[model samples]
Target chain A: MGGADIERLIALLARLPGLGPRSARRAALALLRQPQTRMLPLAQAMEQAARTVRTCSTCGNLDTHDPCGICTDSARDRGLVCVVETVGDLWALERAGVHRGVYQVLGGTLSALSGTGPDDLNLAPLLARLEEGGVREVILALGATVEGAATAHWLQDRLAGFDVPVSRVGQGVPMGGGALDVLDDGTLAAALTARKIYS
Target chain B: MGGADIERLIALLARLPGLGPRSARRAALALLRQPQTRMLPLAQAMEQAARTVRTCSTCGNLDTHDPCGICTDSARDRGLVCVVETVGDLWALERAGVHRGVYQVLGGTLSALSGTGPDDLNLAPLLARLEEGGVREVILALGATVEGAATAHWLQDRLAGFDVPVSRVGQGVPMGGGALDVLDDGTLAAALTARKIYS
Candidate 1:
């Protein structure tokens, strides 16, 4: 705390997610020990990101590009867009390699109790993107919670005349998971009812 | 993983103490959401610290000044000094508000197995500070562990010719810790032998 600049840096770092006062001290000390390797580079990166980063105009994902990398990637499937609740979810789906289509981040879900409505989300931009044509299907990859479901249902009602098919990700026991002993009864029951023929 | 700048920021942040890839994403999002309040300020703080913070030439604690604030404080006991193994230890002591004396960090301890020796530590500077005179007592406030004991012993031996009353902080059962039933035999025995009068 003796150095004003160091103390300021530690205090600022403490506000970052996952770091508290004690850990911020450790991080500050660590950064100080490797000024060239960690401190300078991290400061430069943060400044650069803060200066340039913007939300993707099409999908509401945080990126340096207005349209975002995924929205502009020519190789990605433009006819199928996956809708999600947040940028974290978009990143999760990207990390999983489960879908090749571009994504749409809702920013948040409709929470009736909390007074969040359709306009509160990034839904208008998504609709505008869809209206531009070429998209054939919309995948609702929202969470399985009440808010997520309500958002999906509302979006479905709004896009009723869009002439594009929309579907929620299928619900069942998770793949490579949900061993009978580990699964809850509702999941087990759903998986059993949705049982399909073996290929 | 979309925008190069955002991705690079996340990656660098992940390298910080207490942060991994997942938390880095969360931090990035948080910073992005409050660019003016958090991101720009934090980046500026880090840059300022990187440029100005330096090890105090007199005591080894980090500060912008050569002699450090603790060394310059007139009310603190100039004749008494607390010795520790690292800056974190110094901070811990400062936080406790127990000592009115200044501090000297050893930087590290002697370790035969790790090939660390006396010259590798901040011992020379400490000796020089003592040679400047008026260090009546040197408190070895290192840990009770073997490495701490070894460092303390080495310092005590080196300071024998100074005619200063060197002392290790008395240790036994920690306050509010190691209840009689919970304490190990070695701690219980030490606590018993070191017990003082009720007066």
Candidate 2:
């Protein structure tokens, strides 16, 4: 229904995480409908990002700089590192403004079904960071999924030789989550087991 | 959490249909993660499409050519033209492979709430196509909505001066649709009204 260029655009857009072939066509049409305002700018932005963005050598995070802003930021506590499964997770922690520390992006978790071993993740830089030896704590901020837990256990075992302490993010009832009826079995169990005393 | 270029890419992606800020960020990260394979090609495709694709003069459909492929195709019947609300609708018809005629994209339908009137649509080109003559039937293949019906009525009235016959696509129970119990009231009524006689 469109030229090869438009078809190619749609096909490439379909490769994105959330977009499929149909929505990619819709997105392409929406872009074509407003070339000056949407298409050109998006093209320019993609081109710019593609040209400049690179993975950080120090922490496996993505940024234009080699060390990344987080790695170079003196104000943030480099001694307190948060290990996450992906760059998206790192962004989530940053967005919440809950972590005033540096981050290590593992790219992905160790999944047995997917044949993802410890070697598949960005573990070398993490070990290098630990070997440098000023880090007080390494917080595993991975997901609550099975693979996340497996990855955390693997990392904990690997980091046992180091002087730094290893800890996983607490699992319990979410801060703003609904009552017990809505809570899943595992979450309710964790919440009960981790119950704290009143002041 | 990222460089300026990455931020710009995410912001631009968020402007697309069916994508919000969070999904856009995820998309950006996906693109950034595979710059060589995904991001560069997508950017190139968008740039090429932006530079080449334009609205067809004969129809309102978008293509690299002036008159579009459908309008110029010798195999198709020029005497039969399908008037649709958008290029997306034209694509839908083409995907169905049920139409052997050319198309006239109206760009959009008339809407009172959105203040979209006849002047806002691509009616002039359609009239010009009719004035040039040889069109036997002008099929209204618009949506089954209030605005679509209103636009069809408006177009029918405007085309009263033309010699060509005007007809609308049939309204009935959809092909491969679910049981009658699941049909909405309007659809059920329409189906009943447009019921076919048994052979």
Candidate 3:
């Protein structure tokens, strides 16, 4: 009756990304107050997610099935593939709606300082997919960071002997973001270099 | 294969306090990534909490029992009752570790604008508790807001005819709260009025 259950719930919630101890406690109390409306449903949903969610066999993307929706879909462009650093990056690209191709998750970029290498990532899977033919282009949609560059370079060298063209998604001024006054020097330079003529 | 289970879980989790859509998605992905370590236990705990936790009959406190642990505990000072506006307030007092007594939850304070009166609150249980026996004091630990003041005043008027003394918890500069420059005028005045001699 001292609410040990609530305390345990709070402790568990504290491990979530955006919540601290105080916010966890608040969330716990909120959940407890609306147990029927919120707590039970959330609990059930989480249980369902735990039971069903798994990594895609082909792309390393998290899904309920091995091939994943994107990898198995016939409507998507089989000739094009977008390579991303993480699942979050893949989701971001999906939300942007500019790319209609499938994705190959790198798991993470090569970071020499962190002792991460090509073998530690999903390079084998990408190479395997490319080797099967029909994919004419591989777009590197990785970040502009040092590790991202190193990984992209390694991938470029790996696919150099292959006939398929490997290119990077261009970096420039973001949509509705960073005006002239607010844009940093590096971003400004990149924007200028990658500037496209308005069609 | 699109992990609809995980997405649904994220949608449900986003409804919780302190978590938005973005963080909910991140949390869902994180939980999926470590099902055994995090997700399963949290789901089980929420299920447990939903099953067992209930509002105490003796005091409006929520706990696993009819009479909350605080209300039933003989170790606590039964003669002193701390009246609070909400369960969150009760938890806050518990966290503060200053109160050595049980609590009576008002559910909410009296609000003229919202048309909440004494009858709309949990005053019946409190009155019944007061009439039954050895309670020597009732402390109103409600906030210093308008509704709080009105509720306190109403309680004071009702308890005037009773044998037990009814008091309000003093307001001052909170512990580890407010620099002189940052303190609002009302708080500054309250702090000044409730000033204590330095030990």
Measured by TM-score, the strongest candidate is 2
Q: Per-residue lDDT of B45-95 in model 2, one digit per residue for the tens?
A: 888998899999888999999889888899999889899999999999998
Clashing pairs in 1: none
Instruction: Supply the DockQ value of model 3.
Output: 0.67
Q: Which candidate comes out best when scored by DockQ?
A: 2
Model 2 chain B is weakest, by summed lDDT over 10 consecutive residues, at B122-131
Q: Name the best candidate (by lDDT).
A: 2
Error of 3 at B165 (Å): 2.2
DockQ metric for all predictions: 0.71, 0.80, 0.67
lDDT of 1 by residue, B1-199 (tens): 5678888988998998899999999998899878878898998888888788888888888888778888888999978889988888888888888889988888888889888899888877668868889888999999877788898888889999988899989878888894589888877877888899998
Of 2 and 3, the candidate ranking higher by DockQ: 2
Which candidate, 2 or 3, has the higher TM-score?
A: 2
lDDT of each: 0.86, 0.90, 0.87
Error of 2 at B17 (Å): 0.4
Worst 10 residues of 3 chain A by lDDT: A1-10
Better by TM-score, candidate 2 or 1: 2
Off by more than 4 A, model 3: A112-115, A179-189, A192-199, B1-3, B112-115, B195-199
lDDT of 3 by residue, B116-177 (tens): 98889998887887888788999999999989988999999998877899989998787788
Off by over 4 Å in 2: A179-184
